[model samples]
Target: MFRIPASNNGLYLGSVPQSAAAKNGGTLITLDHDMATLPAVGRTLTVAELAEHVDDMAGRLWAAGIRPSERVAVHMSPGFDIYVLATAVARIGAVPVMLSPALEGESVAALLERLDRPHLLTDGAKLDGPLADFPVADLTDRTVVATGSRPGAVSLDDLAGAPRQQPVLLHPDEPALMTHTSGTTGLPKLVVHSARTLRGRFRPQERLASLVRKRETVAIHVSYVHSRMYLALAVLLPRAMPLVIMNDSEPAGVAELFAETRPGFIETHPNSFMEWEELVDHPRRPLANVRYFSTTFDAIHPSTMDRLLRASERRAPLFFQIYGQSECGPLVGRGYTRKNAHKADGRCLGFAMPGVTNFRLVSRNGARPSRDTPGYIEVSTAGRALTYFGEGERFDQQVHGGWWRGGDVGYRSGYGCLHLLDREVDVIPTIHSTLEVEDTVLGRLEELTELVVVAGPDQEPVPVVCTRNDRPLEAERWRAAVADLTPMAEPVQMPLTELPRTATMKIKRIELSQRLRTQEGRAS
Candidate 1:
């Protein structure tokens, strides 16, 4: 019953080939922006073919000099290449620092510098562009590798010439993976995870697996660089469930793909779900076959939930909204149906995931013994990350005793369900709860897609809204929406796509506010 899985090598990689061998391989789609490319369209592989590919990549990565505790920065878009290459690095016990393409070049260079400019692996586009941001003097000290040609970098294809080698195993506490947090409030910091912390997620993934019937098709369009994504793939791909992995969440593209696959379970970021809500009007009704909808990373608006459930044809389709952070895998989970979606309070995030997490509230006055009094959220979770890479002192600051500070302000309802108000840094000095006010406005208007409250010039609550169909904001509707609450600044309209976002789709309030202030200065 005991499994001695290779460290840093996601366990599923070792087991998937064996489990899938001698059987029809489940589908693995690598949906990317370049739909015309070979890696984009769905690639169907037999278990043997999948096994062969993993082995080949693993061997190549070992040949590339990726060794135990080595850091390899991955600077590619999410797709088959990224997944395979990152896994290959893990196979050799080198930690893959998962970086997002959406990250700005300046931030990327700064983060690389902070990480001590570890071995950089990127593509032709990044080598000549993003990578150019680093100081010229620094390039001489680091080994650069990329798929296409670069003056000083080694060609990735050269790895094929080097002999293949078996994976290097390490202790459970050794570093295995590294990814940056969303950085909604400040510069993103790298978070490191070891087999010890990562193994805790295995049980929850297994529990999630039992909920889905064996062999049911799964369609996933979420971030690959996210901390839990590798673990998720480790569990799902090996289960032999046919999969559709998408990077581009464009409504028509995803709808067309789902029409052909007819996936039973659909999992994506909450924002993607909202983006896909337009599929409700699609002639094919893409979500009709979906039985379960899983959303993680942040709280979702009730309207977004309502639109999606009504579109699904299932009689009792369940929507799982997960509330937690990358530092901690998942602290709480709550499910809502069409009937209960509208009934949900704006803040009722969820109850703790059983046997996996322990949570408490530390108020300004200290620990709160009762419910409904909002306070700083804290948790002791089996799945918490080991530390912030290069910032062990910062990691120590967030922990008190054995509990990890969640950096959120929320309270437990009388029924024990959690209600998150605002992130500690996002809090406004409004007479009312800033997030509660945003939720109230959301409930009042059906056409409003998203509303975020940020501090304005006078330090008052200023609401930024993304309206459906890009409709003009009506002052009357806005006035009525917040009529009973504290007087607030007039709403500022913003296009949803223009909003600065973390990889998970959570808005960057501080960034957007600063941008707006700069624009105002120019106009005045």
Candidate 2:
């Protein structure tokens, strides 16, 4: 048996460190400057006080019949309130089911059903406006816990007044958080992660001591509902002070927050950083105090990395290009330092981190593995998820002998770096018999900002390009560019304002294909 680490000394999901700023009387700032920052906003809560509040909230939830292992859905926007609610659920050894407020009603209802008897904690206004129309009650034995007053719901403020009690201790392998994927392919899968898995991914033993000693102030720009939430709670919370941004995530707002908070570390999606790049025009502020900047959840464009390196005033190391699916924690990451930053072949998604994780590439034809050959990426991790909520077939196909096939296709370079290609389903096959048309095209069109090559309605290849320049490309110029590749790519080029992206910023090829089909039908 793989022995799980003790929760006392090692970082555990849902438990904040006794040495945290919230405990040391350093305030937790919710960046909501538009509205008056509350007394709780700037005033620090000591670790003891924060624990007391969590205990009180947990006891009330328990009184209301919440039990350990029960899934409690938190449906609020980013804020301190979300932090409190999530921690409260964790205190009682229950799993917090996190969902973005932006998700459609149908998706929300489906997720609730999959989680089972989910206690919905949401904004009261949303419930009355759209959520109420859904079959929320039928999905689960859900009681509406509202942040603000609305009809047919209990106020979250009332729960705080309940008696305080010691929180239940959880085993390291116990499920702590349920984070859903973006569901771009189909229904979103509920990824259940244990305390140990969460820690392994976030608080690697190598960085644990430094984090604790420094007591760094960490800023998280992604939504708290993401898998990164567990990382924040398990790893960063135990070591650093957290700055939570409440308003919509705009690049300007994020830049302003960075200026105000001056955190030592920042964790966010690559797209967020990219969007922020547009807003930040002035010379980069000296982030001398900032120790690390981590990007995850989506592909980091090479151009974005270049811009960040150029814009950074303090010249801190570009920490990691994290790669992992929701089912598994961060499987791989690579640090890009100044010495190796400009090495030409773009950024490599580094090797595997220590702990019980292994990776292999399975070929499309089920052939044996070959070095430098592209194949479906599969990972075997000590922390692999148990099962999908309802999709047994998907669960079975992907999971084999403890290894999960990540549906993505990629190759390991001679330098041992992983270079991810497009998804297996998205691979465009042409009559020219070249399986690598997409890669060839992408390699040739490196100057283009964004490109998606897909099979058009007639099964002919089409290229959709989103350029930095607004002007449309001349047809002759586009044809001449791909002239070398003849009948293989009879490319129909279209200019798009911006590529439609999923929440994670992956190009939605299926949606793009549908749009192309609609256009083709109209033309016909």
Candidate 3:
């Protein structure tokens, strides 16, 4: 068995592939789609080959005038190349600020302004689409297009074969990368991470990886801009597990790939897992080989977990649910087996990682924190981000005496499980937990593809429901499902695609609430 490398200083993304190659050069990495940056390389690669590509890209970036300590904002089209380009920027000791391609131009422009004119790496599609109205030149120091070029922009494709420079390692405490929050509330915050904090995030996940006793192909579908993507790679690569990185989350495509690869371990966004529930009954039995399934981005329904766990043919398959945010890495998590998955409570997000993470429930109004009066959840961990770029005071406001309150309000269970109720901003006075109602109703309604509870225009609880295939929801069925729960407004049925989502597929509850209010006003 391979042991995790000592990371006392921190993990440097520039050298991750190189370090992995040294341990297992032939370890294979499979991709669902081809890389736009290196189209000639094809879809399958080995760790050694991946290292060369990263090295080459680093050289091209250096040739284009990127220097240590400068910020390179990567806001290109969605693909595996996003991760490659980000690592290349880090190789030159420069900070790679990742902006989701899903972000609107206004938000992107605002973030770039906050960066104080950082270099931008984007493509033709974004420039001509959402960002069409923005003055690209004024919002950025330099615009480098990875796919198509503009007159004043630099073409990353043209920088091929530039001289490769030696890798530079920044101090462990120095800013190494920047990733944005989910932006569920409003504009996303650019979170700053040091190499040391990244190492802190890596250690707990490495321990989780150790649970697999044998070598297994690992499949991951994660947002390239999220810090979890890099940490997942860091954990799997050195262990030399065969890797499958998927760019498409379409159920049909996912089924075909999983059938071929038969990955033994899988980790993806919780919403993606919900979407993939249809694959459970596919003829290919795509999930049959999966020994472990995991989600860290959001709260997953027990029903979804049960469906997936039952699909796995492996002996005693496990589903690992980790509760975390962009500001901090995996804080608390628990694993579910087939025996208890169907009966599991969605709110009990499990306990902290034994030695690396710890959490507390701070009373909001001088009362005992419980299900009725949930307290603010705060955590103490080395994995916390340093500060929000250009918003130090905003970041400071969340940190109280070294413990970070991430705007979530929850309480600990009698047995020590952390029960996440709702985001502080999303809570409604009439409902104990909007999320809890959603979880219960969703568990009862198999037809629902998605369900979100938000405050209505009149302060009533509104349930926005999305059914599979956009089929009209049966009003009677929805009524039956929520009958035992608290009273709520008539369910608002909408297509899942129409719902506003963050890069991680989380519903923008606040935005949805406002939209509902606007629609109500328009109707009146």
Candidate 4:
């Protein structure tokens, strides 16, 4: 369904930059922060330069003994280098397992064990900080440090003059990359992806990218470990779009970068966009040149969408909200303009991509699914991950007849708009959709930077709030805002930093709920 030439062949992460460089060596890529691996290379580079760095890193890995088809887990210090390193691992024909830097040391060690002692690529910061208490030596086959040296670890710097090896291309169906789930329940699961499967995830996004008639700089601030980041590069690089990779999400830093870069296309996690709401009024008009604002992680608040859309001076600026999961790529989405964003229903996520994707709501009870009684939201797409590495049975439970049922409960509107209500695990007896309540209250109270509703110790719907700048939340204002909505527990105001978050900035609802329960237990 996509006209992009790169889509014809499988979207192989290993060869993406090389192919792009071959097509257009001059395509500019600007980064907000310096790369960890290439510390002296500076922040800006051409497509050719990036490909060269990837090739050099691949040679380094080859010297380090990472061979074709072997698994290499990448859990290193934060930077844009993670993607480059993962790509380097892929170039050598080994699957790059992406473990988010935000993952706890325990979780990382556990995931390393799950990979059956895969080679680990990390940095000394992690070795000395979060991982200081864990016996990392017992969890992996070999430890390769990308930066700094640790005893019993191979350093990439030591192999600077290693001979370059030809890029290895595995079978389209062979595992090429692995990323973990958000781990809201427990340790994250390793999601396995192949060249062909990654291509599946690329097509819909390719079609979306095709919508941009003119070449404008595309700025992206997504988790370095996410499949979306790779797919986004697959779409942008081959097309030779000028790219800006953002490492900072702070409002002031983002303002300076966006103002200086003047990116026309911007994409980030929904929560990041919410955090950027303050940028709307920046004197420099940081978002003025933006024509498209896109987010794929979760349903964003209408207010946040409206503010960003209005900030753009471009004619017909659009905010695209794509509802998707880690396992299945972009499933359904619709764009909103300033004219309609304020009135848009937070629950009514858009329609599925025609031909490329399809969704079905399986009944929770004997009756058919509807607004009141949401059902299991399952999707059938080529973009679905192959399987959970080393957890085949757990993966099997979610698949039925080629349909992947992510643990989400939602219904479809009469007009076929998918309405996401709540995750099955986060559902409370007192509320139909915790997310809907959050969206409503957040839109009503401008002071709120974030809001989440989780099941309290008594199964009561508790609303957890984080105000802008961590200011005290006015009791009367909050009461007035939720007056017309469902009854909720007393608001628990906390610093935004205290809320548990995934790499992509998604709130760990289950973790937050567990903390609430623990606090209640202590009080009693």
Candidate 5:
């Protein structure tokens, strides 16, 4: 269904720069990772200049003996450089693999082994100890190309600096990038996607863009490894849309970023938004210019949606909470405004993205639910990844008749919107529905900052909560929050930042429970 050119670079880097410089070239991006220095110290590149950088980097990689389809891993700390080199790799018709910095060291090494020991392009620190345990044989043909010190590693800086060469265009079906799932549950799974698949997956950006006017600044704060790569290269770069990027989600840093860029549109992880919800009251009013807030990767907490939308100054601004998976792009999207965010409803994730996706709900006992019923969610999208890179059996198990089985548990609302309950693996057997209880608790307990209900060791319901304003958890308030509902274990209070989370910022219940167990053991 994708009619984009067969070029490995979806839109030529040269062409993108020309479009960017012509339309909106001045100060197109401000990348921030440090809170102390402010955005001024961060890299701010105009579109006119970034064009040269892309070409120069590609020429450097080519001169360094990189070739088309060579899988390369990017383990650099998140920054503007990751995007530059990633584009250069695709520009030269090579496949770039971005291993998440969130993956545990062994998980990172395990994924590397699965990729046939691809050339590693990263700063030396990650390779030093993370993969040290892997024998040289398993890491055979391994090469480390660094921008910093590494014994025997090639210096990217030492290569030729010419960028005038035109990028090579490969077949549309040629693989463009290989990435792994955010290892929230266990070891990450490798996923492969082709140029055509990437093009079709981000097709909705045009429509999503139409929601606001052109020439507006767009802000994005998600993993540099995720689908934002496509949005940055395919959608935003061409428009010369100004961007504000933050790898660090510390509220103070994000506040300063938006204070300067004053982003008109935002797309980030759901929990990241929750972490920044405190920015609503920052003196700068960082969200003042936000016309839309878009979230995906996981369902957002109700309180998070409530505060952020209310904070923005734009009249009738919208919140787009998308429910999707890493294996597939956006499946369903629901729009909420200040007026509707507080509307009494379960955790609704919205209807399918109309023509973009088809969803099915298969319930207990292996039957498709005839009505609104909680069950396993499955989706059919044009952009589903081709397969799990090396595990053919695992890939086969996830697909049936062109529909990929989603591991999430949810139901289709009577009006066609989808309401997610939780991950099937994260199911908590509460007397009341887990989502219902959580949403209700959030609505009643405005003082509660963050809440997650997980199954305790006895398969009983337990809650982990963060109180508003750093106040100690109040047993009376916790009891009152659940008084109208059902009796449950006392909430285990913890600092919000201490919660175990996936790369995308989804709470890792299994890991969090283990941490709590460890803390208890130490206390005893």
Candidate 6:
């Protein structure tokens, strides 16, 4: 068994023994563009191999001047190398600043500028054009370790021969990972997590014993830079060999990999799961080995959950849905089984994760009320981040004392399940009353192919619905739909052709809202 020091201060996240995997005879599997084909169970690296690689990589990073507590930026595709580098950084007592490869030009540049002078570890081919435009040289004096050959870049192979160094003993409170908040409001804020906080937030003990027994083959299809990887690996590692899918995690790609790898469990975002639904012709494949599926990052529409349940042949338990923010960590999860499916109102995020956390609901208008009363959800947990980096004002407003205000308004049901109402900004207050405009729009347009609701600058709600056909939605049908609601919310039905979205498929509500206001002003 791996033994990490029980320290209240200076907790280091990567302090667990590197050789523990080798001692237990486990393995590590990774898939990337460099591989001849998707990695299968038999072809994956053994635990001994992974531990040796981590040791070698850590030594090389130290030789390259990555001192303890220094931050090393990792901008690479998901794979075995990514995990190795992350583990290596931790073993050396350095922080791993993970950046999603899917992040676009401006977001990437903004993040890089915020984390100045970081030792970068990346797949150089992915960094060719867009990253070259930035003042990379001035930002960091450190050298980059590129996985593949690139002009003026050092290769990973060169580091294998580097001399090994003693692992740094770090306190539990030391920052281990740097993650960015979802840029939902303005620029994305940086969040710093410590080893103590992560351990407390994600109680790795409960799942470890079972996971070890199964020795399950697991596939991590989400971006390693995201919080999902941290949550999944921290819980899955003691027992199973994690298969990292580095390239596009689209359904077609993931299905092909699944067919080859035969992983017992798969972890991914709801969007990727939906994409997978569209790619495969058969709802149920010969996925005899697979047993569990988990989703996070965003809420999955009930329809998408239905599709997943059907596709898995009801062979696996209901897909697990986890809800949390980058600052608060993962706070809640629900198992989507047939027994609980009918009970779900498509609103309850789930009950709290038992022991590691607790929650409170503070009214948007400032009063604490009973169940059925909607208010902003505030969470207090041991896993909450220590501080928001570079966003003092925003951080102060959101976090008061130990309670982090999650801006999203929700309420508890009589049955003790938590139901998310809407985000503070997403709620529309009409002349008569307030209403969760987005929830109503999404529920009403359930039959539509796609839909998004944006609050216009005039503070009016506009619904953009995409249907399979090009036919326009009639004025009467739109009016009737809005009229049937409890608190009447004004709806402007627009074609889907006019909507804007982010790289991760989130609607750009602010931009669309601005456009709507401009058009309304012109008409007036």
Per-residue CA lDDT of candidate 5, range 193-220, in tens?
Answer: 7766676577655556666665678888
The 10-residue segment of model 5 with minimum total lDDT is 33-42
Question: What CA RMSD would you report for each candidate?
Answer: 3.3, 4.7, 3.1, 3.0, 3.5, 4.8
What does candidate 1's lDDT look like per residue over 461-524, in tens digits?
A: 8889988888998988888888888887888898888989988787888988788788778988
User: What are the lDDT figures for the candidates, one per model?
Assistant: 0.74, 0.62, 0.92, 0.91, 0.72, 0.63
- The alpha-carbon lDDT assigned to residue 187 of candidate 1 equals 81
- Residue 259's C-alpha lDDT in candidate 4? 90
Compose the digit string of candidate 4's lDDT tens values, residues 26-138: 99999999987788879999999989999999999999999989999999878889989999999988999999999988888888888888999999888899889988888
TM-score on alpha carbons, each prediction: 0.92, 0.82, 0.98, 0.97, 0.91, 0.82
- For candidate 4, the per-residue lDDT at 136 reads 85
List candidate 2 stretches off by more than 4 Å.
Answer: 1-12, 17-53, 203-217, 241-247, 283-291, 338-347, 366-373, 430-450, 459-461, 467-500
- Model 5 segments more than 4 A misplaced: 1-27, 33-42, 132-140, 160-165, 344-346, 366-373, 517-524
Candidate 4 yields a Cα-based lDDT of 0.91
* Consecutive 10-residue window with the lowest summed lDDT within model 2: 32-41
Q: Model 3, range 1-524, lDDT digits (tens) per residue?
A: 11222444888888898889999989999999888878987999999999888899899888888888889999988888998899989988999999998999999989989999999988888899988999889988898888656889888778887988888888888899999999999999999998889999998899899999999999999999999999999999999899999999999999999999999999999999999999999999999999999998988999999999999999899999999989999999999999999999999999998889999999999998888889999999999999999999999999999899999999999999999999999999988898888888888988999899999988899999999899899888888898888899999999888999999999999999999999999999
lDDT at 376 for candidate 5?
76
Q: Tell me how candidate 2 scores on lDDT.
A: 0.62
Error of 1 at 359 (Å): 0.9
TM-score, cand. 5 vs. native: 0.91
Q: Model 2: how far is 331 from its true place, Å?
A: 0.9
How many clashing pairs per prediction, in order?
0, 4, 0, 0, 0, 9
